[model samples]
Target: ETLMEWQEQRQKPHVAIFPGFGSGHHIPLLQLAKQLTVYHGFSVIFFTAKWMGASPHQTPPSSSGGMIRFIELPDVQIEGDHAGMSFLVRIPLLLEKANILVEDALTSFP
Candidate 1:
């Protein structure tokens, strides 16, 4: 970025937060997200994989507060595996897709 663009961006920093697919990860991650928005002046987007939840019936929660947003992908399926195992196998694919999403989102900035 040019110096002018960089200076303007600091006025509205953007952070993309994608924690691991378990609560042991998401809990602390959420806290960090809160701090980044509340203290650091960053706008953050939190991504959760489609299958991640305490129970299958539970829906992914949403945050409407300014500077924070949440998005969830559709669940992945791998043939001939138990549900738990499939989650681990699907992580890499999801990460790749998320990276693409991030790059696309960045292009809209500036």
Candidate 2:
């Protein structure tokens, strides 16, 4: 089935959190997802690139009769002389992709 059609079949109150690349962003995003699921009882989805090296130690508990989910995307490796690229040049790209992933995930929810 097509992606949009599959998304349309999902349950309600779904939220996708994207932490993007690097440990700094990933950690907090995971923590936030945990809090939302455990305390707030929200169905939270996490999106991260496979190359980011982030993984959950334990599965999030299911709520509202459905399970929490993690979606991983293929990592983008910019092959260039990073010896010259500045943080200003790379940070925005990371944020942009992260946002895109979150949007994609959200679009799947009802």
Candidate 3:
């Protein structure tokens, strides 16, 4: 069968949503994913950093539907030593690494 037919036969569409680093971006995306799975009947997968996976504020996945999945990636940290540097100096590097991790996650998705 064709790809579309195969997908239809399975009766589910897989969707991956990746939010930017930090809680500001992650919370909304996660809420949206839950809504999509619980109310809209779509399979939702969330790609987030390891920190999010360990967050205590987020809701647990729905147990009955089995439509949502969480994929946690390692926290992206700066490689070099910036000993005694100010927050401003390290912030950019952290953001850059997070962006790189996001790109890598997207490219590696199947």
> What does each candidate score in C-alpha RMSD?
6.5, 5.2, 4.8
Model 2 C-alpha lDDT per residue in residues 1-110, reported as the tens digit of each score: 57874564354356767665577877787777767766766677777675566655344434423435777765554556756889678667666766675676677745
**TM-score for all predictions?**
0.57, 0.58, 0.57
Model 1 lDDT tens row, 1-110: 57985676567877877676677777777778878877777777776665555321143234424556666555554455455566556777666766676566556544
Give the Å error, residue 93, model 2.
1.9
| Candidate 2 residue pairs in clash (backbone atoms < 3 Å) | none
Which digits, one per residue and each the tens of the lDDT, describe model 3 over residues 1-110? 57985576358666777675577777777777778877777777676665443341366565526666666667766676777778679767866777676677767754
Clash pairs, model 1 backbone: none
Report the number of the highest-lDDT candidate: 3
In model 2, the Cα lDDT at residue 97 comes to 62
Q: How close is candidate 2 to the true structure, as a TM-score?
A: 0.58
Question: What's the lDDT for candidate 1?
Answer: 0.63
How badly does each model clash, as a count of residue pairs?
A: 0, 0, 0
Model 1: lDDT of residue 8: 62
Report lDDT per candidate.
0.63, 0.63, 0.66
Question: Which scores better on lDDT, 2 or 3?
Answer: 3
What's the true lDDT of residue 106 in model 3?
Answer: 64
